[model samples]
Target: MASNVNIEFRKLFINNEWVDSKSGKTFPVINPSTGESVADIQEADEADVNQAVQAAKKAFERKSTWTQMNASQRGELLIRLAHLIKDNVSIITELNTIDSGKPLTASIGEVLQGVSLLTYYAGLADKINGQTLLSDGPVFSYTRREPIGVCGLIVPWNFPISILCMKIGPALAAGCTLVIKPAEQTPLASLFIASLFKKAEFPAGVVNMVPGYGPTAGAAISNHMDIAKVSFTGSTEVGKLILKASADSNLKKVSLELGGKSPNIIFADADLDYAVEMAHQSIMYHSGQICCAGSRTYVHEDIYEEFVKRSVERAKKRVVGDGFDKKSESGPQVDEDSLKKILDLIESGKKEGAKLHCGGKRMDRSGYFVEPTVFSDVNENMRIGREEIFGPVQSIFKFKTIDEVIEKANNTHYGLAACVFTKDLETSLTVAHAIKAGTIWVNCVNYFSPQQPFGGYKQSGIGRELLVYNKILRLSLLYSLQIKTCKIILYCLTYSMKFCVYEMI
Candidate 1:
C-alpha cells in the first residue's frame, strides 16, 4: 500500500453525516498486494439501508432543497464536485488502487474519466428539453419531465470511482436523490467522495453512501419501496436477482450493466502488431476485471501462428506485482476467491483441449497474484470462450473468413462489446455492423468516451450508461398537460335525425 494513502472515511454516510452501522459490525479492508488488513470499515445492514433510503426520500420531497433547486444549480453542484475530485486526484487514485488492486496509473486514468463524466453531465443539465404536441381538438398539449423521486445506485468494485460518477452524474442532473451502495470489497473511494459531496454544498440526503455485503445492503436498495429506480453495474446473475427483488417489492425501474465475453477479431490485412497489443491490453488492463474485457480473440488463419507466438511472449514478460510499483505492468487479483476462480477456469481451458502457450500457474507470493495466461486453438464450445472470465487470461481462436468470424463472435450468450482490426474499410464496416454487441470498436479495443452510450445486447445488460441525457429522462416521469380556453356543446334532435339540424351552444 502507498504510504500517503489514508482511509479517512470508514463509516456509513447518510444525510451528509458519517455514523456507525445499526448492527455495530465492521468488515476488514484488505490490501490485495500483501493480503493483509488495512482497515475495518463500518458495515451497513438492512437497518442502515432503511435509514439511507428514508433520508433520500425526504430529500426528494416536493418542498425539499434538492427538489426545488433549478437544473443549472444542480449542474453547478456536479461541476463543483468534479473540481473537488480533480483537486484531490492523487489521494483518490491511491485509495482506489489500494482498495481495488488496480495499478496506480490505471486508477488515475479512471479518476480523470470520472471527472469527465461529471463535467459532461453538468454541461447537459440545463439543456434537457421536452416536447410539445399538436392535437386534433381545440386544446394545447405539452409534455413535462420530472424526477422519479429517490433512486438506488449500486456500484461494483471494479473501477469504483469512475462508475460511481457515471451513475450519479445523470441521476443528480435529473434531480433524482440517491442512496448508493458501494461494493463491500472496495468502499473507501466511494466513502471518500461522499465527503466531497458535502464540500460541493449538495443538499443533505441528496447523495448517501452505505457500504456492506450484497445480500444485506444491496438487496435492501433493490427492494426498497421508497426508491423509484435502481441502477446497477455488476454480474448477470446478480442482475437477475435485483430485477426479481424489484418485482417482489415495489416494481421499481431497474437498469443493469452486466457481464460480457467480448470478442476481438483481427483480419490478416490489419496491422498485426497493433491488433495484438490492443487485444492484450484489453484483457490485461486492471487484471482483466472489466466486464467488457476482450477475453476471446479471433485471428485470421494466415497470421494465427505468429500472433499466438507474440501474445505468449508478451504475457510471459508482463510484470505482476504490487499496484504501487512503477515498473509493475499488472497487479494482484482482487481477492482469494477471484484468484481461485480464475485459476480454476484456466485449468478448465487446458482440459477442454486448448493449447496453453505460456503462463498458467498462479504466482507464488504473499497476496492473491496470478500469472498472465494465454491459450491458443480455442473454440466456441470451450469454457474459456463461452464464459466471461474476468481475469488476465486470453483465449485465441483462428478463423478462415469474415463470415465465420462474425458467426463465432456472435455465438456467445453475452454481447456487451466487440472489436475488429483490419485495414480494409469494407471489411471493418461489415464486421462492425454484423456483430451483435452494443459497442463495436473498429481497429481498436476498450475505447471509451463520455459522449458515447455503453451497454450490451442479449444477456449482457439491460440499459446503457453515459450519453445520459435520454437515460436521465427514463429516470423521470412524463406528464402531458392539455388546456382548453372555451367549451362548445353540440345538440342534435333524436326523433328525426335525417332531417334534423345540429346547434352549437
Candidate 2:
C-alpha cells in the first residue's frame, strides 16, 4: 500500500492564486477505502463561482495574455503540463486511489492515459486553421478559427484526472480560459493537477478550479452568464439540470457526457473464456463505477448457463479491499451514499425476480466495500437491468437471436458505449453497426483512445470529447465568427452618421 497518499491542496484556485472560498465554508474529503477524512476542502458558493467566472472572463479578453498569446506557446505549456504529470505519476496515482476508491494499478493506468491525452491535444494547438471560401472577384472572404472565451468545466468523481484532461486539453488548446469544478467526493487529484498548471506557468486567470457541492458551486457555473460554454461529465439527471440552468441564464454552449446502461453481448460462436475475463474487467473494474461500464450482459442462450457459472467463480476470486493495496483487484464504492445505493439496487434486483447467482452482500470491513456480485436470469424490465448500478453488481441475460438482442440492447435510454464478443467478422460488423452507442468495441471492452471522439447517443450526451484535431478546428471557427460579428457591428455604427438615420417618431 502507498503510505504517502495525503491531501496537499485544500484552497480554491482562481487567477493562478490559491484562495479560500468567499463563503468561508469547508467540506470533508473522505477516503472511501478507509472511511477516514483526508482533509477539508474549501467549499465555493455562488459568490466564489462569480469570482471565478470574472477571472476567466478577464483572461479571455482580446487584450489579455491568454487570449493574445501565440498558439504555439499555448501548446508548449500543455506539453509542459503533460511532462510534469508524467514525472509525478506515482503521487497522482496514489492520490486518485485514496480519493476515488480505485485499485492502484487502475489509477496508474488512468493517470498515464491522461498524460497521453494532454500530450495529444498539445500537438494540435498550432494546427487549428480555416479555409478560404469561394468568392467572386473584388471580394475575398475566408474563415478563421479562435477560442470560445470562458468555459465552465464540471468533472465527475470517477477517473477524476482523466475527465479533467479530456475537458481542459481542448479548451486550453483552443485558447479558452476555464473555471473547473471537480466533483465533491474526489477533488484532491484535481487540486494537485491545478498546482501543476501553475508550475507550467499558464497565465494568471487562465485556469481556475473551485471545489464544492453541485447545488451551489455546480449550479453557479451552469447559470453564470459570463461563461461562454459548459462541459460536464456525470449523471444524466444532473446533466438535465445543467441544461435548464444554461437556458435560464446565458444560453451558453453545453456538452454533456452523462450516465450509461451499456450492454456487453457475447455470442455462442465466440471464445467463452476470453469473453468472461473481459466482461469481468468491464463491470468489476473500479467496482463498476465507470460511466461506460458494461452493466448489462447478454449471452447466447446456448452458453448463458456456462457463462454465468464461470463469471460467478471469477467474481468470488476478486479481492475487495483498500485501493492502495497492491493485491486488491477491486475497491469500495466512492462513499457511504454510493455504497447504500448499490446495496439498494442489488436488493431491488432480487425482488424484481433476478436470480442471485453469487455475491450480494457487503464485505466485512470498515470501508464502504461491497461484494463483487453477480446475478443471472435478469430481464430488461428489472431494476438492476434497467438502471446504472455503478457498483460491482453484474446482471446476466439470455439471448437466442441477434435480432432479438439488438432490440433489447437498444431499448435503454442511455447509450454511451457497448461491446460485442464474436469470432465471425460478419456478425461482429453487424452488431457493431446496429448498436446505438457512441462507442462500440468488437471483441473488446472498455477500449479508449485519445484520437477517437467519445460521447453518447440520445440521453447519453450531446457532444464529443478528446476529438483531437476537429474539436480545436470547430472551436476556432466559432470564435472567428464571434469576433467578426463584433467587428461588423462596430464598423456599421461608426458609419451610421453618413447614412440617413431615422429616429423613432
Candidate 3:
C-alpha cells in the first residue's frame, strides 16, 4: 500500500485504511485545462465494492459502537470534520480545480458549501427526534428513528465535494455507515477527504470511499443486498439503472438527483440588467456543467433581441483559460468526450436553423475548451433547445405571453429547477406556481441553501438532498407499544393507534 502523502497513486479507502484494488486496476484522471493526466486513481471493481459494503454493514449492525454512539457525539464528529475541511480548504480546492477543470474560485466556493452543509447537519444531529402524537388513546406509543444500515453514495464530478456532503452529512447525522463511489473523472479530492475521516478518528468502515467507474463499483453498491439505501447524483439515464438495481436486489430505499434541462423565463416587466447577468452566469458557471443549469432561456418578445445582444457580449468578456489562473473566469470541459458532445450539439443547433449569435466552436488550444456559445431564434424542436448541452452554450427562445412561455418552459421531461425573472407579483407567483420543478427561483439563478429541500418532479430525480428533511429520510421508523391503563378492553378495540411519527412537508 502506498502512503497517504502520495495522493497521485490514490487508492480505495475501506475500513479506514487505504488499500489497493483487489484486481489491481487503475485509471488516469485527466486535467481538462491542459489535457494532461492529473493522477492515476485506483479503480474498484465489484469485488472491492463488496468488501467495502461488507465492512460498512458490519459497522452498522445493532451491536456496533458506531450505531450505538449518542446522536450528539455523532454531531461532534461531523463538526470536527467541518473544521478540518476549513483548515485544509486550499489543498481541497486545488485538487478539485485540477481534477474537474473548474475555476479555482468555483472550487473554493464548492468546498465552503461542503463545509457549511457538514456544519448544518452536525447541529441538526441531536435534534432529529420524533414528535408526540395527539391521539386519544390509553395506550402509550412512540416511534424511534434508527439509522438505515449501510448506505451506498454515488456522487458526480461536476461539484464533487458539494454533492458528496449533501449525502454524507445527513447519512452521518442519521448514524448510517457508507460506501461512497466517487466519479472516475474527479477522485483526488474525495481520496484526500477520506484521509481526513481517518484523522478525525472516524471508526473503521464507518465512512468508506472507493474511487472507480460507475459500471462496476457503482453497480455493486446499488445491487448489494446488504446496502440499505443508495443515493445517486448523475444523469437521468443512469438514475433509471440504479432504481432497477435497488428493486432487483433488496428493495432498498433509493434517492436520485439527476439531470436537468431547466428553463429561465425572463419577462418584459423585469430588471433586464439583472436578468441578463444572471442568465449568463447560469449557463457559463463551471462552463455550464451544472445539473440544474438554466440552459434554455425564454425571453419576452418585447426585449428578446436586446437580451440576446447583451448576453452575447457578456459571454465574450468572460476569460477562459487554465482553472488555476486568477484572471480566468471559466475553464475547459471535463474531458475530450464532453468537448465533443458540446461541439456536436452546437452543429445540430446550427443545422436546425437556430441563429448562432456567437461562439459556435472550440478554442484553438491543446486543452478541451469550448467557446461560450449563444443561440437565438431557437424553437422547441431544435436539439440545442431541448437537450442538455452540459457546456458553456445557451439557447434563447422568444415568447409573447406568460401562458405561452409557461407552456413552452414546462415542455421538457426534466423538471429539476427553473427560474423566472419578473417584477409583477401576479405574473411571478403564477409562473412560479405553474412551473413543475423542484426549485423555482424568481429574479435569481443558481442560488442554493442547505435548509431548502431540492429535488425534481418528473424524470429529473426521485428524492432530495442537503436538509434536515433529507436526514430523516436516511433513517428507519421503529414503533414500540407501551400498554398504559386500559378502560374497557372490548369497547376500546376501536381506539386510534397513538404513535409518534416525524413527517415532512
Candidate 4:
C-alpha cells in the first residue's frame, strides 16, 4: 500500500504525442480506494485505431535504418531504454499504482521487474539464431531467424506493466514493429510508458499505443490485415473472440495468454501454518485480480477442518483499506464494475448453498472496497468454484485420494496455472504432471519469469509469447526445407550440391 500514489496523470498517447479521446469524450479513471476521479483517459475508437495502424505500417516500411541495423545495435537500443526506465523508475511505478488502484508495493516492485525483463531481452537480442540443420537435401541448409511484421499487442488491466514488458521486450527483440492497445481502466501507465519510449527514441512507430475500450480498439487490432501477429492477454472468453476474429479475417499469427481458476491442494502432512498463508496469497494478492489466481483450495480430509479455521482467521486479520495507504494489506477493487461482479459472485456462492466462512460484505463507505472474503462447504460443482471469480475470494474443499483431487483440479475449461503443497517429492512430481495448467507450483504461487514461456491449454489460449530464441526455433523448424534442385538431385546431400559452396561456407 502507498498513501503517496497520486492519479493526476496524462490522458492519452499516440504516435509520440499526448492527445485526448477522438470525440473529445474522456472516461474517468477512478481511485478504487476513494471512489474519486483520479484521472481521465482518452476513449479511442476506430479512427484512433486506424491512426496507430498507419503509423506502425509506416515505421515498419522504413526498414532502411532500423531494419538494416545489426541485431547487436538493436540490442543496444533496448539496453538504453532499460537504463532510461531505471532512471525514472519511481514516476512510472507511481503511475501504475494510481492508475490500477492496486497495492503500491506490488505496483512498485513489479515495475522494477518489468525493467529487468527489458534488460534481459535486450541482452538476448543478438543471441537469436537459427541452426544449420543436417538437411535431407542440398542448398543453404541453414535458416535466418527474422521478425514477423507489424504486431498488435492488447494487454490487460491486471498486471499491466509486467505483462506489457513480456510482449514488448520479446516483440522488439524479434525486430517487429507494433501497435499497442492498453486496457481502458489502467491506460495511464501505458501512456506514460509510451512517453518513455518516445524519450528512448524507439524509432517513432516501433512502438505506438492507443488506449481504449476492448470492443473497438482490441477488436480492431485483431481484424486488421496489416498486422502479421497478434499477442493478447485477457479473459479466456475474450481470447476466444480474438482467435475467432483473427481466423475470420487474415489468419495471422495469434498468441493468447488467458484465464485460470487455479487449485492449491494441501495434503494432510503439509505445514498447517504455511498452507494457510499460501492459500491466502494464492487468491488475495492484488485483490485477487490475478488471472492465475488460486481461487480453489483442496485440503486433505484429515486437515480440512483446521485448514478452513486458520484460513478464515488469516482473512479476518487482513487490514482491508485503500491501496495508496501503505499499511492497508487489502486494497479496494479496481472500480464499481469490478466490485459489482465480485459482490454478485459472493451472493451467487451463498444462493448456491456454499457457506460464507469469513468476510463477504462490501465495505460500507466510499470506493470499491470488498472485505477479504472466503467460502466454506463449497462443492466442486458450484459456480464460484467453477467460474473465474477473479476477486479477493477463496473457497476450500476436502479430498481423500490424490487422483480424485487431481481430477477435481483439472475439471474446468481453463488450464492456466495450478499449485500443490507437500514435502513428498514423488507425490509432488506425480500431482504436478497430472495438472492440466501451463504452469504448476509445488509450494509457490503467482511466480513468473520472462525467460519462462507462459501460456495456457484448451480454450485458455493459442501459441506462446514472452519466449527467448523461440523465433529461431520456429524458423529452423519451418524453413529447413527451403532448398530445391531441378528434380533428381533435389534430395542430394548439402556437401554434394553445387550450391553447397555457399551453403556450407
Q: What are the lDDT scores of the predictions, listed in order?
A: 0.84, 0.85, 0.84, 0.77
Off by over 4 Å in 4: 1-12, 19-22, 136-138, 469-505
- Best-fitting candidate, measured by lDDT? 2
Q: Which stretches of candidate 1 lie over 4 Å from their true place?
A: 474-505
Please, what are the lDDT tens digits per residue for candidate 4 over residues 1-505? 4345454445556566666767777777766777778667777777777787877787767454567777888788888888887787777777777777776667777787788788889988888877676766665576777777788989999878878888889888878878888888888777777777878777766787887788888888889988888889998889888889888989887788888888888988876787688789879887888887888999999998889999999998988776677777657788888899999999999999998998888889888888899898888788898988888999888899999999999898988777788767778788888888777767655656556667677767765656644421236444742311110001121222221101211
Where does the lowest 10-residue lDDT sum fall in candidate 4? 484-493
Ranking of all candidate structures by their TM-score, best first: 1, 2, 3, 4
Backbone Cα, N, C clashes tallied per candidate? 0, 2, 0, 3
Candidate order, lDDT descending: 2, 1, 3, 4
Error of 4 at 276 (Å): 0.9
Model 2, range 196-262, lDDT digits (tens) per residue? 9889999999999999999999999999989878899999999999999989998888888899999
Between candidates 1 and 3, the TM-score winner: 1
**How much lDDT does candidate 2 score?**
0.85
Error of 4 at 241 (Å): 1.2
TM-score of each: 0.93, 0.93, 0.92, 0.91
Q: Evaluate model 4: give its lDDT.
A: 0.77
